[model samples]
Structure formats: structure tokens, C-alpha cells
Target chain A: MNAANSGSDMPAWLVIERVVRSHWSLSARGERDAGAVLLALWADDRRDLGEGFLLRAAYLGASRLRVIELALDEAAPAFPSLVEIYPGAVRMECAVRDVLGVQADSADSRAWLRHAGWPVDYLPLRHDADRSARFAAQAEDYAFVRVEGDGVHEIAVGPVHAGTIEPGHFRFSVVGEKVLRLEQRLGYVHKGIEQRFSQMDLQQGQRLAARVSGDTAVAYSWAYCMALEQLCGTRVPARAQQLRAVLLERERIANHLGDLGALGNDAGFGFGLTQFSLLKERLLRANAEVYGARYPMDGIVPGGVATNLSSQQIERLREQGMVLEAAVVELRAIYDEHAGVQDRFVTTGRMSPELAQRLGVVGLAARASGSPRDLRSDLALAPYAGLGVQAAGSAQGDVAARVAVRFDEVIESLRLCDLLLQDLAGGAIHAELGAAAAQQLGIGLVEGWRGPVMIALEATVDGRIRRCHPHDPSWQNWPALEHAIIGNIVPDFPLINKSFNLSYSGQDL
Target chain B: MLDILKRIARTGIVSEPQLKLADLLSERDTLHAEIAGILGRALAIRQVDAGSCNGCELEINALNNPIYNIEGAGIRFVASPRHADLLLVTGPVAKNMEIALKRTYDATPEPKYVVAVGDCGCTGGIFGESYASCGRVSNVIPVDAEVSGCPPAPTAILRGILSALASPRR
Candidate 1:
């Protein structure tokens, strides 16, 4: 097996190597409460990457970073669960158990990512299990932890929401109108993306990554392609890199616009929704005309990008950015001055910096709560390194803080967009990439609008994908939601949830 | 409030002019794309994400924007399936979401129509059929019409709904 070190974070890499020091040099064995476990997932080594069965786990940490993993064989098919250290790792550890049959020693030992839709032994990711096998709908009865009190009662919200949103069940324990606990039951949108990735070649997998979560298509696809290019040692052109930046920034702005409006609407401001929706529509129309897709799902491909902007098109984009900046500034003022909105937003759904740090929250939500860990700014690469990126954040850690971060980012993105247009890289838009070598593994990480979207891809001897694990930031942040809603009232849960906007589909897979 | 009103007035109904279904006919879209205003009565739609990538949801949400201004037309998204006349479902039906989708479909009253939005809803697009996916919206519930795009644009999606509404009630 190629223990190709994922040197995305160099400091963490050294720590990981030291912690998991052994012959194979990867073991989280007997380390029960060893720091925060960012992601705990296992790959079936019977397919490739090794000769026999294998298991692994690693640290995707920013606070007191430490890495640990154990290479499991047929005999030792379990690893010590780090759910206690990384409180966020509970769901991931459960997911690992359900899909791969790799057990973990955690107190909250429960099934995740699967309801009774499949057989109890039906681990689709296991080597012995048939990949295309189907299962009948069995009885589903997930035992949600109940709160025992005189007046405390449960309020089940969804697997289906009121609006045109994704599906996930929220079980809220309430007394009167104030909430005591909020437990989220996701995996309602689990599309078997990880298993599906093995069936596709690298090019086809790029398309699958785009669909992992539709909102952050540019970021996901770029991360997938980056991993592929890294494996093949293909150098992307300067112009293509710049264009990818343009697409990524635009994607970031569009999502922030959507969330910004939703935040206001949640607090009962119709004007905010109307004005922001109008602006978003204008931006989307421009995207369709320029990138040929409103969401630009196919914008970023392996070697470079699929499309390029003309000088006139670039100029038009700059103009749109300027207009958006002016509109956002005006909207921010209205949101700030408005009494009803501020009353709802200010102290409601607050998570302190310490709680955020302990839970290991990453991405925009983390930044808002005062963890300045942005991949673009922290690990400045080609485009982001050259065109300066100022990470927008606040220490308040409320709906208002998240709003402030979004507003700051939108303006910064506009500036970056204008800068990119002014200094458009003059070269070929795409570079022809060669085939991947035998038994190669590579890691690709991008700071998506939500947080770091990482794609760990490994190719077989003949160059087909053996295993591809797409890690979403939602896995870490979703647990933070459970904590964020602690003392907040039932009415403010929606606003708090919107502030985080964690992805069900991204994490479910 | 004056600032809000002035800004609203300045923006002033940027909603697109609705064309008759005949004028909107392309060789490909001629079948499903229909006139939006034909259903003069307001439409109450309950959108279900059977298991979409949420690309379809993004565009579906776009229908609310001023330019498309879906409410300006007779169509509006409702809170409950019981209140809905049409079910706008998206994504290839994931196996886990199948039972919930079925329950939701059952909750909506009779004479309701279903329009599966996006390529996934239509034909299970990219992540076709898997252990986790039921492949298409029709796999769980009956579908009246389908709009196929990675995510069909807001206009195409609106037309698909209107077209489904044009059909005889179930």
C-alpha cells in the first residue's frame, strides 16, 4: 500500500507521522481520547492500495492538531474511536461502521448513513459484498435519545422540510418554546457517492464530485481534478488557474448572497429577500451567458477549466461585481438599522469561541467564531497567493456574526473578481493531461464556501479509480449545530441553522 | 421604510414577460414546455427533494427571484403537501428517502400532479442506480412530467410545472 502522505497541512503531517509511529506508520490504536478526530473513514483495501483488507483514520484539525490511524487487517477489524476527543467524529465513526463494517470503541455506538433500507449485514463497501446488490425496505426505527422531564416534549421537524430544501430529520426537545436539545438525523440524501466513485474513471469521477453538493460544484470539481492532476503530475496553465479562481469566487458570492437573504427572511425581513434575490438572479443570468451554465457545474475540469471568458465578457463581469458591491453595502445598512431584524439576530443562537474550538468547527462558521483557518489565505496557492485574499471573520459567533462575515466576503470577492479580470492570465485555458500511474494516491483540498472540501483519490494498476473519499466540512460542523441550539428558543433554530447551512448530501455520502 | 420603498420602486417589476407555450417551442422543449398563465388560478406546489444534489433546488429556489417572479405568475410554493396541487420533486430517489417521499405523496390530496425536476429526477442523471439510489422520482411515486437539465433553468422548470398542470387531474 502506498502511504502517500497527504501533505496538504505540513505541520499536521509531521505530528501525524510521530503519533502513529509504527512499521506501516499509521495507528490510532489504544489511543482513546487522543485530540480531535476530524474524519474517521475506512477504505476496502481488497480493491487496491494494498494486497489485503485495510482501515485508516486521520486528523483534519486546526485546534491542537494531532493525527492517528490504525491499519486494520482481517484479524483486527476495529479501531479506537476518537468521538470523545473530536465530538464531531461520532457521526463519521458511525458512518464508517455502517458502510464498511469497521467497528469503533465509542460510547454512542449506533448506526449512521443507513436506515433499514438495506439488510443489517449489507455493507456495500466491503470486499465480500456485491457492489450492485439491492436490498428491500426493512423496518426503520432509529432510537433518538429522549430527554426526561416534566414538561419536556419532542418536536420532529423533517426528513422533508416545509420549503424547497434538502431532506434531513430534526428531533427537537422543547419545554414551552425554549429548546433543551436538537438531534439531527441525516443520510436521507445518501446517494452512495463513495461506492459510485469506484465504478467511474477519473474524468467521470470529476462529474460525480460536482454533484456531491450542487452549491459548491466549482470547488468540489476543482478539488477532484486537482487530485487527478497531482497524481498524473500534470501542470495546469496559468490562465486556467486564474479562470478557476474567477469561477470559485463567483460561486462563493452567489451562495453568500442566497444565505444573506435567507438570514434576513428568517428574521422576518421581506425587503432583504426581494432585493437579494433580484441581485442573485442578475448574477445567475450573467453566469449562463458567460460560463454556459447558470450554476457552472461543468466549469472546472481536470487539466484546467472547460470554458474561458472573452475580454468583453471579463469587462462585463467586473461591471456586475461593482453593481453587486453597491447593492450589498445598501442592504447591510438596512439589516443593521432595522429593529426587528437585529432583535432576532443579535444574541440568538450564539456559540462561544471556546465551544467552537472544542468541537473543532472549520470553514466560514469557524471563522465567524474566530478561527482564522482559510485554505486560500492560509495555504496560498497560484491564484489566491498572487491575488491577495483577506479572510473575513468575527468573534461574536451568532447569526449576526455569520451575516457580517458573508457581507465582508461578498465585497472581498468582488474586489478579487475585479482584480482577476484586470489581470487576466494570458495563456492556454486547458492543458492535456496524461494517464495516472499504477497504485497512485493523491489528496485535493479546496476552501469551499462552506469549508474545506477534500477529495482523497486512489487509482488502480490500470488507472481506474479504486477508492475515492470526498470529505465534506459538514461532518464536523453538523455536530456543532447540536450544541449551537442548546439554550436558543424553538423559533430561532431556523435562523441558527441557516447561519451554518451545513450540507446533508455532502456529509451523508 | 422610505429607502426600502424607493429601492423597490426603482427595481420595479423586472419579472420576465410570459409568452404563450406555442412561441416557446423548440424541437426538444416543444413537448413539455407550456404557457405559464394558462392556469389562471394560483398553484400551490410542495417541492420534495427525494434525493437531489440540490442543483435542482437552487434553480427551483430561483423561481422566487423577481426576474422569474413565480408568484407574479399563478404558481407559488406551499408549506404542506396537504395544501399543494402539484408536487415538484427533484433528484434520483435515494433508497433512504423513498418511504418519506411515498408518505409525502400520499399526504397530498387527489387531483394533484407531479413534475420531476432535473436530469436526476428524469433519468437518475449522473449517480444513476446504486445501493443507495432508487434511480428516478417515478421509482417511488407516479410522475406526470419531467424537466431534464443538470438542473433545468428556472424558466424550463416553471414551464414543466405549467405543462404538468395542463394535464388531466389524477
Candidate 2:
């Protein structure tokens, strides 16, 4: 993949050709013909750029990420919508329209992120938008697509829930018990994270990035730092790279452990919940003792990691990892053999491989339905490039398949961590980063435990952050959950939801 | 099922003896004296995520784990605010959720204490007062006790809960 010269003013067509020929390239094109060419490449994965309203498309196989700078000189702040070609572009375009006051030239232009919080004219992401201004509170009634029928009934759940969970509204149109359609309304957790990102310096940005989603803090921070390091042409030490891998795997283990527990609990199996929760708790304690923070919030900083693991700490983690493996192996057998658990899991909330592909489902959810796209294996960086990660996948896209994929990934992550710890390279934990070039853009992509997390970063000449967009795997998988819930009874929603375990705050940001 | 029973038998009551209220509760005697008559030894908590990073929520969930055994300490997380004696709110209040948070507070019966958990709950943490955010939990509703870690550890959360019970307002 050619790292296209930012200084070179390449024509839009040539830039597109370069990106198509190579796997990945960063090319700069003039404002003219940017939207037309990008609209031509509309079938590819395209996302909204920051407040500047540029369009980024990753053409060919999910490998090349190309950003097309839209000409803002038009009478109205509008760009051609890619929704006609790529179905996934609907929400991405709507989000940009909702926050940055950019419009997409397509129908179904209802707001996505803005939920009766701000005045219709106020755009929060714009530089001139008032941060402290308060809008009068009003009751919100979202126009959820109605299903008119003899037996169709709507059941609204959450934004707050029965269980202690993050807030999001789930409006289910149902015929008796079976769900006909499920529409989700989120952004109840949005805290203006993107606006806050611009207010922080390069180093401080990582701390804010880590909070994008607490569970995937390491993944988010690593991706943000990777983008910054790329802009500055800074290479992290080999040892630091290995340590980052270790921490990432540890995070994966902890989340999988917790999700497995919650899934069991949702299925009415209390024993599984207790056992798996205990396992997750032990791993978290180990994280606190060894890595400083229970969750590795401030662990990964720009140019490298914030903390270094001593040999003694490494030995302890390895021993604990082995013990965890043995325990989980035994637990898996019990979960598999238990008749009641199997009954609840099999064929429940099943999604076919074809539907999953059409919906662009990703991460563990996609792998369960046999999509077989894992960023660690596909876009291997650093230790993962040589580590040979075995992407966990299953042909069946049911609750059972999701659970099985999680189990397989947990085992794989444990093995990967052991290898990373044993082969600890000798070098400084962090490398001093040089000054970043002005008006430069860099992208960092990491396979977070949930799925792929991509961070696009732009820095000013003086090294202040211009714009940072942290894209969560939740954006791809949340719609998949709506599909997963179809044909299943209302009671099974919690179980099915836990299997995917999409992050609300991550997506809300 | 038999295997599960056998495993449980082998484990043989892994739960530690319930800690004395004085040991876990902050403001020990004051909390015991305040809640001893009305609430007795039991307290039902309803947790609200005003607008959090979910890090604080993770620690809140940790309270339910075997080590902490918050239930064993006579505090349990309830489903609805109507059933709760205390509201454990986490994050800075997002503008979108401000109404819902206030509604939850309104719905709760009298003698309901609110313990603001984590730094965000205490003072809005990193995402302070902004157009989209109202800063801290107190900015939206009255707070009884404030816990102040980026995500206060599970123990800190329990202490905060205990302190809320001790507050004379309750």
C-alpha cells in the first residue's frame, strides 16, 4: 500500500486508482470532483469525516481507507449520499448530518444522534457551536417506522432498564410474542466526546480516547496512539509492541469472561454466571495488581505504553493465565453438556450467514455467522503480523454459535498472551516521539475484543489535535442485533442481546 | 445437574462470612443508627447511568461479584427506583438523559438517597459542563455522597453507598 504523499496534489481519479490497485493509500485530492468520484465508489465502506465534512471510503477489500475531501463551497452544506449503493451508509450519513450540520442528498433524512436535546439549527460538532449554551428541555417522540396490522403491537424498552446496564431504547413491533421489527434509538450516553477530543493536547487525547468505551480502553487508546505515531513517523519499541499485545489479549479475556457469565445468567443458568463472573473478577484483579489500573485506562500512551511489565509480573500473569485456561476448559464442558442451557442456546435468535453479510455484521457476531473477517488476521500490525492469529468463527449464527466463538477466542487470546509474554523483546517501553507535521492525517485500526475499532486523527502544525473520529465495531454490529432478534420471542431478547453485547456508549460517542 | 451439584458440594460455601456493617460502611455508627430503624439491615439500590464512559459501571457491577458480595453486606441493586432506598448514579448527565434522570429521581419514594459514584458523578470528571453535558450528577439532582475515582474501585463504591445511608437527609 502506497502511503500517498500528503503534499502531492494528485487528481481524484488517480487517487482512486492508486487506492484500488494497492490495499491502502492516503492521497490528497482537490475539492472539485471529490464528491462525484466518491459517489462512484459509494458501494465501498465510506464514513463521515469530522466537522470538516470530508468523506472517507475504504474501497476494494476493507483494506484501503481513502478520504475524499468534499468541496464546501456549494450553496448548501450537502454531499451526495452513499446510502443508495451501500446500505450501511444511512446511519453514518445521518450522524454527520445530526452533529456537523452536513446534509446528505437522500430521502429518509430524519436525525440519528440528535434526540430533541438541541435546537434543530444547532450543530454541536461545529467549531463555532456554543458549548455552554443550554436548550429548553422538551419531550422527545421519535417517529419509529410504524407497522400497521391486525395483531402488531409496539413494546418500548429502556433508555434505562430493569437490569443494571447502559441506556438505549429498543422499540419492538411484535405480533403476540414474536418480533416483526426491532428499531433501536441510542445516544442517551453521548457526552460530546468528539468535541472534547479537540480541546486536549496529543498526549492528553489518549486519556480521553480510552474512555470512548471503558471495556475496550486499550484498543481505543492503542488505535489513537497508532494514528499519532504514524503522523509523526514514530516507531514504537519492539518490547512495547509486545506488551501492548499482551494487554489487549488480557482485555479480550476479561470481556469474554464477563459476557459468557452474563449470557448464562440471561439464559436462566445462575451457576454459569457465578463461575464465569468469578473468573472475570480474578482476571480483573490480576490486571489491577500487574498493570496499575483495573481496566488499562492510562496504560497505552502515544509512541508506546505507559507501564512496563517486570519479569516477576510476567511470571505471575503466565501462571494465572494457565489456571484460567484449565478452569474455563472445565466450565465449557459443563456449559456444553447441560441440557437446559443447550436447549435455550440452540437455534435461538439465529441469523443466517447471507443476511449477516448483507447487513455488514462484523466482529464476533459476524464470525459466528461465518463472515470470517478479523482485522488482527487480515490487517496484522506489529506482533500480530508474525503471531499468526487463528480467527474464531462458526457456521451457525445462533446464540450457541456466538457463545462457542467467544470460548474459542478466549482460548486463542490466552495462547497469544503467553507467546507475547514469553517472547518479551528487550528495549525501552516507550520511544520519544518527534513533532508531528502540520495538516497531516493518519489512521489506526485495531481488532478490539468486540470487533475492529478505527481511529482517524488529524493534527495541526503546532501538534494540537484538529479532529479525531473513533469508530467502534458497535456501529457495524448494532444493526445486526436487530436482525438477530427477528422471529425470536420477546423474553429471549436479553439473551440474544448479551450474545452480541454491543457497546452503547462506544457507539453513542 | 448432578455434576453442578457435585461441584457446588466440593466448593463448599465459597462465600465468606458477611462483614460487620461497621467494617464496610463509612460513618459506621451514624449509618447504622440512621438506617437501622427504617431499613433495618437491608438496603435496595437502583443504579442510573446518567451519561457515563461505562468504566464506572464496570466497577459498580464488580460489587456484585463473590469477593465484594454487596448482597451479603445487606445492599442489593433493585430493578426500579420505586423499589429502591438509594439511587447509585454514575456519569456526567448528558443533555439527552437529563430529563430521564430527573424523572427517575421524581419517581423514587421519599427517604431515597442518591450516591454519586466515580469522578464524573462527583464533578463531571473529564467531560465537564458542555452543550451536550450538564457536568455532574448533582447538577441534575441532589447528591448525598460523592465517590471520586476515575472509576472508584468496587470497595470505594460500597463505602460511598454506606455513606449515603448515613446522610441525615435520608
Candidate 3:
């Protein structure tokens, strides 16, 4: 195995071979400290493609960021645990232990999360496990982070909440009204998405990705398609790329609008919710009229988009845009004038740039805190690159900053969508994706509405997916919630949480 | 106050006042029908999430949208085995959700009606079963009606619910 030294002196890409054996090759790329590691396992046979496993490890070294990749042999071998090396690996390791049934030789193996929810013997991701089985087994209790202090009362909230939202448990340790510490207990929304992917083909898989988080359908589907296209070596049509961008931006605008309203409502501004909801309703209706789906699922496919827009539709979009723009301008003025709304949002739930960096927060939360790391702008993918993407960010690192970032993003998205509509080119909506050639691995990074959505697709020679990992920005930002809630009054938790609006299903997946 | 005025000025001038009035009347009519339908029969709904991320639930809750109402449909999501007549579930049931799948099914009071809304819920439209799923709602649950599209438009969802109610229970 090739090992690279940590520090600024290190090269952008470190190629590691025979890390475990001849069967696996690991490539650690990007800057030495702030880089990602890609591990590709050589498939000796087509069956091995279905059987092989790829594991990703992300951590921050003393000076730089460290990411390691491990590819397991079909005959799973005992590998040394990286949990000792990077404490973050503990969660990932436990995940692997539960899903892949890989026995990790670690001291912290006190049922990390593998509650007896499933039959003790059945690993859902594995091929042989019979799905239709009896459910007499009881779920094992998850180990929550422990907290202790005088007057530090522990408040446990929801696997089931009062609102019509997904299930998640929040454990708050507060000294009277001030929050001392906040520990989130997720996985209530864990529906075994990764395991389900094994049962689907490329066409079916795209649909699944879109549903990974309903709101992020456009991002998840695009990321999934990117991975599939890479594996299949298919080039999407330029028009299709433009269409995808339009849909993605629409999704972004819709969500941000809704969030802005929801955050306002959470902070005791119902008028904001009403106005935003009306705007959102209008936007969603426009989407349905144009894309045939309000949320725009199945619109993005592997090679290209599933549908096309006509001149008439484009004209309708422009008309709708005029309406939305006016509404946004109106709302912006209201939000600006509302000192009461400003008071709650300005300094509450502040996360410093240093703290954001340490927690590895991505998307708007990170950007608001002065981390100008936008995948659309920095990565410069096709349609985004053409738009001359200008990222708007702030160092306030507070709820106001996050809201500002979202507002800016909404405006930027509207501009991009209009540009895309204006630059509508005539071409085929989609291309036929052929079978895979060799055992190949492909990575997909899309700027989802929430933030950067990363999807890694691995396939066998016969075009079957080996392992697909769709990483939502929520994974990185969820932890930041715990920190943001600190020092704030317990009542402000809802508003702070709403400002970020991280996904339970996204992170649990 | 200036901002409010600006908002009024900025609001879109869609010639929908007449359409809005018509829709309002129609919505009221639908509400009456829905209430009558609910009162006439205990409508059991099976919620099938073909494959949504669950945003539709927000709007679904809006069935109680306060204004564009649904309780008049006498619609209720039953949680217990005996009380549930309609199974209103969501998502293209993820692989992990399969067990919860059976539990949800077993928990539902039989002679239940199923309404699969959203494309994923209907046919595993987008999120076909992949490494993370079990495919469509029908794959696990016995779906009676399929509401198509990524997320069936809310109107589409209402239509599906109405249609499911129209159908005979098995």
C-alpha cells in the first residue's frame, strides 16, 4: 500500500495499490490535508461485483483532512480497525458491521446500532437473505451520548413528533433554559435505502435516489445519474444538461422559499409562512405544469433528462418567473423591514467559522459561516460553469447569515434558470446507456438544494451496480446542529434547527 | 408598512381572480362531497409512498391545510391494527423499511383501501429499489390505487384519495 505524508508539501493525488492485496487499489486524491480517498476493488468475476464491498473513511488529521478507502475481498477478511486512527470511523465502522456483516475487531462493539430490529442472522444487503420473514424480534436500544451535571436536566424528544415530520430523537441537556449540550439521536427514519439499491437496476436506481429525500429529488437523481453515466461512459446531451440545471435550480428555489417561510413561522412569524407557502404553492404548480411533476422526480435520467420542454412551456416558465420574482422582491422587503423577525434571526444559534470547519459542515450552513466551498462554483460542472456562478456567502455564522445565503441562492437560481431557458438548444432529451465495459468506479458531485450531493457508483463488467454510496450534505451538517444549538436558549432550538433544516432520512442513509 | 405595500405591488398579476373564485367554489363543493363521503362511509386509506423523501407529508398534513381543507373527506390516518381502514404510507419503501413495511401492513385493520400517491409510490417511478430500497409501494403493500408522478401533484393526491374512496373495499 502506498502511504503519503500529511502537510502542505503533499501532492494532490496519492495512488495506493495492494493496500489489502492485489484485488484492491486505493486512490487518495485532492490536497493532502483536504482531500478525498477513492478505493476501487478489482472484480475477478461478475458475481464478485455484487458481492464486493467498498468502504469510505473521512477524518481530519492534525494538519490536514484525511480520507481512507478500504475495498474488501469477496471472502471477507479481517482488516485492522481505523476506529483507533480516526474517532469518526466508529460510526462508519458500526454501519459496515451492521449492513455488510463485517466483524470489526474493536473494543467499542457494544451493539453500535445493530439493534435486533432485523433477524439476528439476516443482513438485508446480502444476496441470500430472504426478505419475507416473520417479525417477532425486538429492536435493540440505541446507545445515546451520555451527559451529566447539576441542574443539567435531560430532555428527550421524539422518535414521533407533534409535527408532520420524519422521526428523530433529540436529547437536550440544559441548565434551566440555557442548553449545556445537545445530542441528536437519528436512525428513526432509517429505511434501509442502501440495501434496497441492491435489488434495482440502473433505471430503477435513479428513481430510488430521487426519493432518498423527497425535497432533494433533483439533486439525488442527478448525482445517481452522474455515477451511472460515468460507469457506462455515456455523454449526456448539452440540452439535457441545461434542462437538468433548470429543474435543479427550481428545486432549490422552491425549498429555500419554503424554508424561509418555515423558519419565520418557527420564530413566531406566521405571515412569513403564509406568504412563503403561497409562493411555494405557485412554484410547485409551475413545476407540475412544465415538468409533469411538482417535485420533478423521474425528470433526470442516467444519460439525460426523461422529458423535454417546448417553446410554449418555456414561455410559461418565463411568465411564472415574472410573478415569482415580484413576490420574492415583495417578501424580501417585508423580511428586511420586520425588526421582530430580524431580532430572533440575527445572533441566535451562531456557529463560528472555526467551529464550522472543525465539524466539516457543508452547504449553506458552512457558507453562511464564511466557508465559501460551493461545489457548483468551485467544481465548475457543465451548466453551472457556463452560468459564471457567483457564490454569495457571509461570516456572520448566525441564523441571519444562513438565511441570507439561502436568499442569495434563491435569487441566483432564478437567474440561472432564466438563462437556461433563454439558451434552450434543440437536441435529444436522452441517450441510451449501454452496458458497462469493465469493473469501473465513478463519482458524481451535484450542488443539491441543501448543498453538495456526492454519489459514488461502482459497477461490474456486465453493467450491474456493485456498490453505490449517495452522500447528502446533511451527513456533514447534522453534527453542526449540535454545536449551533449550544449557548442558545432551549426554546430557540426549533428556530435554529429550522434555519439549517438538515434531513433525518438523508443522514441516516 | 412600506414593505407590505411593496409586496402588494410586486405580487403577480395573474388573471386568476375569476379562476380563484371558481376554484374556491369548486373547492367548497369538493369539501362538501368529501364530508358527505366520510360521513356516508368510514373511508379506510392505505398511504403508499411509492418513493418520496417525505416532503409530500407536509402538504398531506395540509389536507388539513386550514383553508383548502380535507377533514371534510373524513380522512384520518389510522395507526393501530384494528382502527385503520386506509393504509396511507409513503416512499418507495426502502429496503430497511421493508420490515416496518410488514408491521405497518399487519397493523392495519383488514378490508383496507390503499392509495399510492407520487410516482415512486405508484410504480417505483424514480427511486426504483436500489442498494437502499425495496422498490415501489405495491411491491410490499397490496396497493389498490396508484397515484402517479414523482410526487403526485397535491390535486392528484386528492383525486387519488377520492378515487380510492370511490372503489369498493376488498
Clashing pairs in 1: A27-A69, A28-A69
Over A193-223, each residue of candidate 1 has an lDDT whose tens digit, in order, gives 9889888888888999999999989999998
Model 3, B51: alpha-carbon shift in Å?
A: 9.0
Off by over 4 Å in 2: A1-53, A59-69, A72-74, B10-12, B16-22, B25-34
Task: List the global CA lDDT of all models.
Answer: 0.81, 0.79, 0.66
In the order shown, the chain A TM-scores of the predictions are: 0.93, 0.90, 0.87
Q: Distance from true position, residue B140, model 2, in Å?
A: 0.5
Candidate 1 local Cα displacement, residue B93, angstroms:
0.4
lDDT of 3 by residue, A1-509 (tens): 44422322222222222245322222222322343211111111223446365444433222222334555556663345544333334455565666666655673564433445455556655656565543443544656667776767888875444355665668898889999888876654555666566556666788778777878888999989886776666878889999999999898998898888888888788778767877787787787788776667778988899889989999999888877887777687788779999999999999999777655567788889987767677766777777888787999999999888988888888888899999987889898887754445455667887777766666655556655666777766777888899999989998999899888777666
Candidate 2: global Cα-lDDT? Answer: 0.79
TM-score of chain B of each: 0.85, 0.87, 0.68
What is the lDDT for B63 in model 3? 53
Sort every candidate by lDDT, greatest first.
Answer: 1, 2, 3
Worst 10 residues of 2 chain A by lDDT: A36-45
2 versus 3: better TM-score goes to? 2
Clashing pairs in 2: none
Better of 2 and 3 by lDDT: 2
Residue-wise lDDT of candidate 2 within B19-91, one digit each (tens)?
3344654454455556666676578889999898889888888778776776765678999999988899989
Question: Which should have the higher DockQ, number 1 or number 2?
Answer: 1
Model 1: runs farther than 4 Å from truth?
A1-42, A47-51, A61-69, B19-41, B168-170
